[model samples]
Target: ARKNGRVGIVTLAKRPWLTESARIFLPGLDLEKLLDELQIPVFYAFEHVSRRVASFGTPNSYVAAKRNAMSECLAQLFGEAKQCSSAMSIGDSEIELLAIQELMSELAMSRFSTPLESPLQFCKTVLLRENPSLVQLQRQIESLANSLGSLVDHPGDLSLELGTGRRLRLRNHLGPNLR
Candidate 1:
């Protein structure tokens, strides 16, 4: 494994029952310490690799798999950070976050009684009626998407900046042009 151009070796183990099954070895950083600091279980890396191998083919190398797993973990961390920051901006407590989670859960469970043109429209209607505070957040998200212009239509061309000083490219495997 390599972190910031520094070459290191990672040792991973799999155990079906253990929570922190995966392990890593680096020159300066301790895997257990790092995971503790990040507040993420070591098994997250294993879970990521397992899911990737199940969905796609096995990775070419352990290093590649490790890098991909780390990328996924970092992306998740950044997403949580973005959500927390947005929620904090709205209020001091976690009410906004909890409300958003509840709204998403409700949306997922809802079986729209009436036929709608699109699921997005249905969601918008529900949000407008159920939670007005989320309307501004939705608009902000839509504005961000709109700023991407044509990239919004072509997911393969979309690259998301996760506020981690890195750009994550959306790969469209099923698309005719895989770039």
Candidate 2:
């Protein structure tokens, strides 16, 4: 209906007679191992929404991320086809650009992630709006990216430390003296 919801999951207790092999859970796969492998930080930020439940981050990040992955893993539980609706306005990209001024010098690839930090609220409100054109969203993302001017030029080996000092040395050339 509204594209996003949430619910708890449970394994059915009743086993009907004449149960087929397809009804059984397949063995041999390590469920814990499978979940640990996902990119937890990414999925936490960009939530997927669809016809079924809208899952959030849990102690079991794998199950949460999987249900959130591609929106409504419950649909898969029902063995139905994926949503035909295409609200995937955002293109496929591993990088989500954030707005940083010239003074700042940190670019983190961790969770609680953000793509833009200026004029902050509006972008999010319009992200799922069907009325806005795709170009508008792209512009928003680009505008957000452009705001982080430091990233545009300082593309080199660098690090951002929390407690200590310098941690990166990149292969960049020094400029001539302006004397």
Candidate 3:
């Protein structure tokens, strides 16, 4: 720690027992080089302590401290993994939707048959905004609304869960085209 609260001097010796996997993953991580690049005045904390006269920690203590740090790091990594998975799923759904939309547009344009002059026909054309993809997505969403809605709403009280715990329930909210 420093009086100005910017940085403190510290020295770290590389653990010789670092695994091959770690070396492979962090091939370019040179701690000394990093410290040098930072240009911070750093020093080893144990420089004044006589190594031969002092044995401060046991292997268990070291393991526990490392474990705590590793757990926090793993938590961050898992969060990133979840985010990446969600993004990937959304991207995949978008690609599929685009493909379906293209197919529907081609089918709609290819057909030259005259649409019947009925209220239902006119309503669909208006409601769907003349986009076949939108119409298809709407139908899929409406079809799932009943079944999925029941699962989300409490069977007895019909109360809804309002947090991230209800994420699965919102799966239908993404719409049928996304699924």
Model 3 / residue 83 / CA error / Å: 44
**Decreasing lDDT order of the candidates:** 1, 3, 2
| lDDT (CA) per prediction | 0.32, 0.26, 0.29
What are the TM-scores, per candidate, against the unseen true structure? 0.22, 0.17, 0.20
lDDT of candidate 3 over 18-82, digit per residue (tens): 33334676687765565456543333323323454224554333333332332232234344211
| Highest-lDDT candidate | 1
Residue 65 CA displacement from its true place in model 2, Å: 12
Q: Which is the better candidate, 2 or 3, if ranked by lDDT? A: 3
For model 1, how does the per-residue alpha-carbon lDDT over 98-120 read when each residue is reduced to its tens digit?
33333322332342432241133
Residue 76 displacement in candidate 3 (angstroms): 33
TM-score attained by model 1: 0.22
- For residue 95, model 1's alpha carbon misses the true position, in angstroms, by 42
Model 2 stretches astray by more than 4 angstroms = 1-40, 44-131, 149-179
Full candidate order by TM-score, most accurate first: 1, 3, 2
Better of 1 and 3 by lDDT: 1
Give the clashing residue pairs of candidate 2, or none. 5-54, 98-115
